[model samples]
Target: MVSPERHAALQQAWARLLDGYRVTAAAAYPVFDLLASAYSAPDRHYHNLEHLAEMFRVAARLTAITDDPAPVQLAIWFHDAVYDPRAADNEERSAELAATLLGPLGVPRDALDRVGRLIRATAHLTDDRPPPDRDTMILLDADLAILGAAPERYARYAGAIRAEYAWVPEAEYRAGRAAVLKRFLARPRLFWTDLAHQEGDVPARANLTAELAGLRGGEPAA
Candidate 1:
């Protein structure tokens, strides 16, 4: 459960994000409730309120750099709002949910479209194209900030993700996860924005390389 203080903070943040669209608080709480409930799903381990809060923390430092931060903030709130590890359309579903909920709150049609696109972009590794704009880059980088977490935190994040896919056999899970990490390593750049690369690239690469090595029963290179 989200702490009372944290919940209040989230509420304040929601109100501020909504204000950018001139959305009244009266019409926004229900949508906030929907997103909160989704993130609180029992199946969610890493994609819970903690992750949401972390994204906000990352956004707090990044909003100033984004071309338009409001939609980026909104996108962060809804990016993983419909996560289901077994589902291929999680991003699409999350974007759809955001569009449906925010439309009634008076978010402009163009802004809504942007929010939807931002949420969908969190399906990051699934696509090869780079982030299309500064706002998209900020949103994607904020969502991926976890990759550069300290070793202990990164290990926990990996463990949480493994737990989420516990139904898969260890060997299959390792193979699939290794493939995902390798794909990222093969990329010319793992992060789009200069801010993200400066803050996260080295640590993120180290984490991925270490995890991949562990998955393959080998030591990470010196």
Candidate 2:
């Protein structure tokens, strides 16, 4: 969870972003409250406002590289907006929620489409991928940044993800989680952006390797 001051700062940041789109504070505050409520839901062990804040930091670092940063920022706000630990279509539903909410809030159709694609890209599936887009690359990199976090934080992330899937039996959860991690590990690269690649690539691989071992009830890979 974020500190009270940081949470206030995040609110101010959201207000400012909405103001840029010419959304009046009256209209913006309600939407902000809705998003806050969705993210702060009791079922969430991860994928909350804190997660958004962390991705915001990564977006800041990536702003210089993307042709357009606004849609990327919008995606960050709404990507996990409809997370359901048991659902296969969280990304699709989140994109729909974003369109349902953002359309009347002044986001243009084209930008909304771009934002939807960016949000969907978080599924980490390469098949049926969005067109080659720098913004998509940046957003995907930011979403996976937690993978490269220091060991303790990475362990916490793993535990929290498991908590989010707490209903799953240990044996089944381990198999499913291992498959996801293995797919990432099999890839030639973990992060697409040069900045994220430099900062996260090696460590992300190591962390994924370690977590895969722990999932199998063994020590993290050396």
Instruction: List TM-scores for all candidates, in order.
Output: 0.92, 0.94
Candidate 2 lDDT over residue span 1-222, tens digit each: 778887788788888888878888888888888888888898887888889999999889988986668888889989999999878999999999999998998878998898898899888878234338788888888898999989988888888888898899877888889999998888887888888989998999999998998878744322
Candidate 1 per-residue lDDT, tens place, 135-220, comes to 88788777889889999989988988988888888878888999988998887777777877898989999999999989998432
Task: List pairs with backbone clashes in candidate 1.
Answer: none
Which predicted model would earn the best TM-score? 2
Worst 10 residues of 2 by lDDT: 213-222
Lowest summed lDDT across 10 adjacent residues in model 1 is found at: 213-222
- Model 2, residue 121: distance off in Å is 1.3
Per-candidate Cα lDDT values, in order, are 0.84, 0.85
Candidate 2 stretches with Cα past 4 Å from truth are: 127-131, 218-222
Clash number for candidate 1 = 0
